[model samples]
Target: MTSTQVPATPARVTAGPALTSAGLVTVLLGAALPLIDFFIVNIALPAIGSDLRTSSATLELVVAAYGIAYAVLLVVGGRLGDAFGRRKLFLIGLTAFTFTSLLCGIAPTALTLVLARAAQGAAAALMLPQVLSIIQAATTGERRSKALGLYGATAGLSMVLGQFLGGALVAADLWGTGWRPIFLVNVPVGIVGLVVARRLIPESRSRNPIGIDRPGTVFLAIALVSLLLPLAEGPVLDWPLWTIALLVVFPFAAAGFVHVERRMERRGGVPLLPPSVMRMPSVRQGLLVGVPFFIGFSAFMFVFAVTLQDGLHLGPFGSGLVTAPLSLAFFAMCLVSSRLVTRFGQRVVAAGLSVQLLGLLVLIGTVLLEWPNLGVLDFAPGMLLCGLGQGLAMTTVFRIVLSKVSPEIAGVGSGMLTTSQQAAMALGVATLGTLFASAGAGPLGMKGAFALVIGIQAVLTVGVITVARRLPDPRL
Candidate 1:
């Protein structure tokens, strides 16, 4: 083996032994910020475009640039965390994220805001992977399992809560900052997270930390940017030449990335992502499950936002109120999900998907029967069902996917898992978002478009449930 090709071993750190209870809370708090930020900004986009006097195209750039940067650098950040220390990387990332949020909040131009969002995304990339890695490195057995479940719950809760908070903040327009508070609010939260994390969170890193795999990194970056950029910007720009060219480059870059990683492994050297890691059935199956879950969840968030504001003529606050039931039930179910998984085992995932499918059917029915007249109260039943279904499915799947990841490469495992999630999310917004936009804009009308997309998602969920039922039970 080459100097850097040491076999995966135990997690080792110079700083401490077990992570404290307070430590887990601190890290989970750190984990929630980036995710919440991701969804929160959407509610404020209209105000952003108007205030900045930027066209629809450039405003979309504000979203795309951050997402692309965040998704691309995730694995790199995770690798660095394993090499350095999780706590150290988390602190640095949190600090940088806070600064960037300030930059975003105060930016004078659309271009600058876009740039700031990119920096913020890069900071998030640096911070997020370490949460899972920290739990992997410091906790064991049931503690680790509980932590992972909570992480999953945190993730599911964050998406809906971000949307809820974003609408409230923008509608309040606190001090007439007009959408700027959404970014600025991160400042205080980030500061608190930084302080608590440094004091309570334990430091950990891999015993055999791998060096940078430059070729793998470059190829992966090209592949994701080629795919994500085109998808993120294509609909906005109406499929320009450059976007098509990038799309054409995506598969080749992805192939090259795979080749580089495998070649490095064959040659007894380390690659950014070890082939062995992906070879695990738990990891593979979990990811397969995650892709569809993330796609559906993100697409729901995206389309619902558009539907509420544009189709129903609701203000941001009213939109949030409509989703309030879902958000609340999602939180409650997330807490209950852990217990259900323990009692029901592998069947819980299938059950969750079934519930989600029913919820979607209810949603379609509600839209068909009530829309144009559907108020916040009228939307409650379907929203509550969706919340319960998603909470159960999301938490259970998270446990399955990351259950077998070893501590030595926890960061890698976490990074790889999260990258897939972000890719699925980007794909969701691109594909389902496009479908909803086109349908809503056409004679389908907002109500019909809404039902159609939810019906499509319901079918997708049914397919996922079939796969979930067929899988072998997870060992964890």
Candidate 2:
């Protein structure tokens, strides 16, 4: 490892025992679970709905309930970690997550599964922010950056792996559990995480940990729920009056959240997010890149899974096989991207965007050309390129977003970034996925819908590149 001095900031000056490699691994393992669970359900949804006799709308809730709860609670979870302790919350969240997974696995009804999924998401919110907070508090400079890269890799890998693994588990029908095994598998993993985390992970909290910013926390939750809830469930419910009311309230809620947080910060009370942190050019521009990138990334994944299965008439495992290259390529590319970032600075994101756009174009062409004949072998090149590009963009943005954050509010900063990401994932699925569903029902059909979403994603990539060029160059 390259030698680098710890930051001389008082937070670092009084830092605890240097974080062990094992500790970092343990926390990162904690990070992987929520993300895995998030996408794992996608492939298993049909199985879940079939077995449970659920309506299409209820099945969609199985996904959205988790995402909405996870997104809303993330910032508060971070604040609690800062005020109490990261390790404590990590353990608490992990334990809750494990039990919730079991609850989901054994759920006998659609409502039961939805509730458990929401609970699992809440548990995840508690656990995830601590992963980033612990890294920011326990490590500095190059070590911190490397840890963040692994976190990013774990994240990107989890999305693809979740789909693949879920397919495998459902296909295997281990003990005839079908979709249940996808969730049950997390129990053992979470138990191991809890055990190792307790032994290896060092406890860390903010040096000047502040009390919960109640107003900011409340408003933040309201804003996110108002926005995410409608987007996630609106189309499924035929865009009801409540959903419309929430959508109308979303802007006012968000503005109120910002106003309250800023007011709290000016009073010298640490808000959920320090307004100053948001004002940083790096954080601002990095988030701009992240919003669309994640929206496109997630929308593409959701749409691809559906197209591979429903449109192409492939089984879960067959569809997963088609996408597995994306995961593998992403993992391989992410392992090396930190060095690329160290060399090329912000331009790496631009380059990654170029590659991602190429990959999207290829995917569009292949789908258009192959249509009914498209299969795993045919998807290899575009999938590989897409994953490589995603790995680069995701890892780079993870670092850039947190680069300027001071350690004192690392939990809050990390929380904000993650919340934005989770919210975007939820929103993308709601909007882009809705668009696909709508288009699929029209004369255009499923292949046409797939092409439409992919094309829009290509446009979104260009938007990210445009914003990326304005970002402050990396200092490394």
| Best of the candidates, lDDT | 2
lDDT of each: 0.76, 0.78
Per-residue lDDT of model 1, residues 62-125, tens digit only: 6666766776677777778878887898899899999999999999999899899989988987
Clashes of each: 0, 0
TM-score of each: 0.87, 0.89
> What is candidate 2's lDDT per residue for 329-425, written digit by digit as tens?
7777778887898888888888888898999999999999988997788998999889888878887887788788776555556667766776677
Model 1 sits at a Cα RMSD from the real structure of: 4.9
